[model samples]
Target: MLKDDQFWISDDKAKLDMSVIKGYLARSYWAGQRLEEIIERSVQNSLCYGIYRAEGQVGFARVVTDDATIYYLCDVFIDEEFRGMGLGKKLVQYITQSERFRNIPGMLGTRDAHELYEQFEFRRDGDILMRRRPDHMRS
Candidate 1:
C-alpha cells in the first residue's frame, strides 16, 4: 500500500475496479483486442496494483511472479486525465521498493516509456526477450 494526499496505490485485488481496468485496456494500443475474460484471468493470477483517487480507480499495474527470483511487470497505465501528476512514478516506486519485491530481478518490454522505467533502473540488455504466443496473438 502507498498513499499521497488523496491518491493511493494498493495491491488488494478487492480494491480493483474491473470496469475501469477493462475499459482502459479495451482501448489501449497494446491490449485493444483482449477479451474481458483474459484480462480477469490475468489479474487473478498476478500481483496487481490499483491506483485510486477520491473518485475511483485511476491507474493500474501488475507483476507476474512466483514470489521469488523472477518477476515481470506489465499492463501499467494511468488514466489520460491523471497523467503528468507523478502518480505513475509513485506506482513504479511503490512496486520496486516493496519488501516483497526487493532484490528480485524484474523485466518488462515497452516500445515507449523507456525513460520512466529507467528511473527505476530498468535497462536494455543485449539479450532479446522471446515469446512463443500463437500467430493469432501477435498484435
Candidate 2:
C-alpha cells in the first residue's frame, strides 16, 4: 500500500468501485471499445490496484504478470478531478518499484503519457507501447 494522507492505493479488488472504473474506461480511447464483461474478466484475471480517498474510488490500474519474467501494466487512469496531483506517477511508481515487481520487466501502452512513464525508465517500443527494462528498479 502507498499512502498520501487519506488518499491511498491498494491492490485489493474488493475495495474497487467497479462503476468508477468502468465509467472511466468506457470513455477512454484505448478501452472505450471494451465491454463491462471484458473489464470484469480482466480484473478477475489480473492484479487490480484501486486508488481511493474518503470519497470513493478515484483511480485504477491492473497488472497481468507471471511473477517471474514479465508483466503488463494496463488500464491505468486517474479521475479527472484527481489529475495534476501526481497520483498517476505515484500509482505507477508504487506498482513498478514494489517488492514483487521491482526487478521485473514490464510493458504498458500510453497514448500521450510517455514523459511521465519515461521518468521510471519506460522507453518506446511502438506507437503506443512502452517497455520497461528489467533494471528499472528504484535505486
Q: Please give, for residues 1-139, the per-residue lDDT of candidate 2 as tens digits.
A: 8778878999988899999999999999999999899999999999999999999999999999999999999999999999998889989999988889878988999998999899888999988999987764545
Q: For this target, which candidate reaches the highest lDDT against the unseen true structure?
A: 2
List TM-scores for all candidates, in order. Answer: 0.88, 0.95
Residue 47, model 2: Cα distance from true site in angstroms: 0.3
lDDT of each: 0.83, 0.91
Tell me how far the alpha carbon of residue 1 in candidate 2 is from the true structure, in angstroms, after superposition: 1.2
Q: Which stretches of candidate 1 lie over 4 Å from their true place?
A: 126-139
Candidate 2's TM-score reads 0.95
What is candidate 1's lDDT per residue for 23-133, written digit by digit as tens?
999988888999999999999999999999889999999999877667888899999999999988999889877777756777877767777877777776533331222
